[model samples]
Target: MKLTLRLGKRLNRSWQVDAMLMLLLGVFGAFMAIPLIYVINNAFKPLDELFIFPPKLFVRNPTFENFGDLLQVMKGSWVPFSRYIFNTFFITAAGTAGHILLASAAAYPLAKHKFRGHKVLFTIIVLSLMFSPHVTAIPNYMIMSSIGWIDSYKALIIPAFAFPLGLYLMKQFMEQIPDALLEAAKIDGASEYRIFWQIVMPLVKPAWLTLLILMMQMLWGADGGSFIYSEQLKTMHFAMGQIIQGGIARAGAGAAVAVVVMIVPIVTFLLSQSSVIQTMASSGMKD
Candidate 1:
């Protein structure tokens, strides 16, 4: 009877813990979602509704005027609106693609190979993550200027290829691969590069998806920082800033830009979320 009571108590405590976790998660989700919901609603709100005293969380009457205004605003641009779109798309695509390939390549060797100073190198990388990118921005700018890469795409894309966090995550994921599988490939006359491309790459589909999502988030809303100079080289984010600069009369258009700026990352995350979760589950540090 005593043992039965103890078991029952244990089960009760587990249930209590589970309930607490669920409640906390629900509250947190609601808090995070409220702003996103408001943003979506605001995008459809006409200018009058936007400025209504006491504001609103939802639109009673919806209209496409904001989006239309966005196009109209862009139509008067000195530079073609399409040029800004192309620049943003190109920068994001090039930066993300380069980061993934280079980060994955660097990760493979760090995870599987034993090389001199390897541990030290990885230690430095982890340490580097503790500092903010702002700390390195000046030096990075100096290096870019020294190389005559200022006002060019290479300045933006090349430095991103060595982002420490991506390399760290990719390395951790790669470590989950069995050494035996790699050895088997080697015995079968597979070169290191061939094994990496054919055998190893396919197995980490979820990690790649996770990496792609991270890279997308970093690149999608970029404004070309101090690296880009030419008017034609400016990104959609710069155009968004110009729209927002229109002030009160263009508030709805600004909201439309916000919606567009937010949608790409949100859609990308939704598409890759399942894979990211699976990858993260398998990537937990193991003893």
Candidate 2:
């Protein structure tokens, strides 16, 4: 199939094609955004509006009743809402920070240094991505139990450091850094650690920011991954689940919880998505 081209001094695709593509993309984007828009609208909806027969996509009677009701319900719980908030924040902060440092450190050697079994090791990491986390869930649970990490923060934070996709993206992005930079640092008597911390880390800002967004999204929505059995160790996601499961009377409050759950990740993505895209543009080759 041939696309029509027009000459405006230099030849280019016709405006008709560009407009068609944009129209299609606009329609697709609207379709994908419907659920998020519904969630936001439902959060402010009163109980009567929520129970309307032949329910509407948009809220007609918007109010903060849902949030107020949500607060009331949370207050009735055995554990305070603030404790769950702290648990979620701590896990997300620790997990994201650790994953960034460890994945970057691991990627630097794989991208810049030549050593035995390097290709085999990276190939294994790439292949690991093809498998789902559920595949190893049983073994992971057994190991956590045996190691006494169950019902603890370590069970949540430590495993995140070895995230396969994080290492993969970091390594691919690091390959764009020229070897001469590291060589020059070495010639000046810089240790490998010094070269990595001072020389390499500074140049990979975009990559780490990109990884930060990815890891933040993952760890932010985490529900302890079934590893923590204690109520105090549960994250915000677990609290959201409990709220939403409270049957029809609590539906308004549930919507409020859902809205609150969605806000942080969306704000985080809005902040870091540009840097993620910039780094991804150059993350095409591996050394």
* Candidate 2 residue lDDT tens string, 1-287: 35545666654567788898899999999999999998999898898988888877898878998899989988997999898999999999999999999999999999988899999999999999998988988888899899999999999899898889999988988888888878898899999999999988888888898888888888888998589888988998998898899999999999899889988989988998888788867667544
Clashes of 2: 0
Candidate 1 weakest ten by summed lDDT: 1-10
lDDT for each residue of candidate 1 in 1-287, tens digit (9 for 90 to 100) = 12234544653446667788899999999999999999999999999999998989999999999999999999999999999988888888898899989989999999999999999999999998998978998999999999999998888788878888999988888888889999999999999999999987888878888989888888877787688989888889988998999999999999888899988899999998999999978986543
Q: How much is the lDDT of residue 26 in candidate 2?
A: 100
The TM-score between candidate 2 and the true structure equals: 0.90
Task: Give me the overall lDDT of model 2.
Answer: 0.88
Itemize residue pairs with steric clashes in candidate 2.
none
Evaluate residue 282 in candidate 1 and report its C-alpha lDDT on the 0 to 100 scale: 90
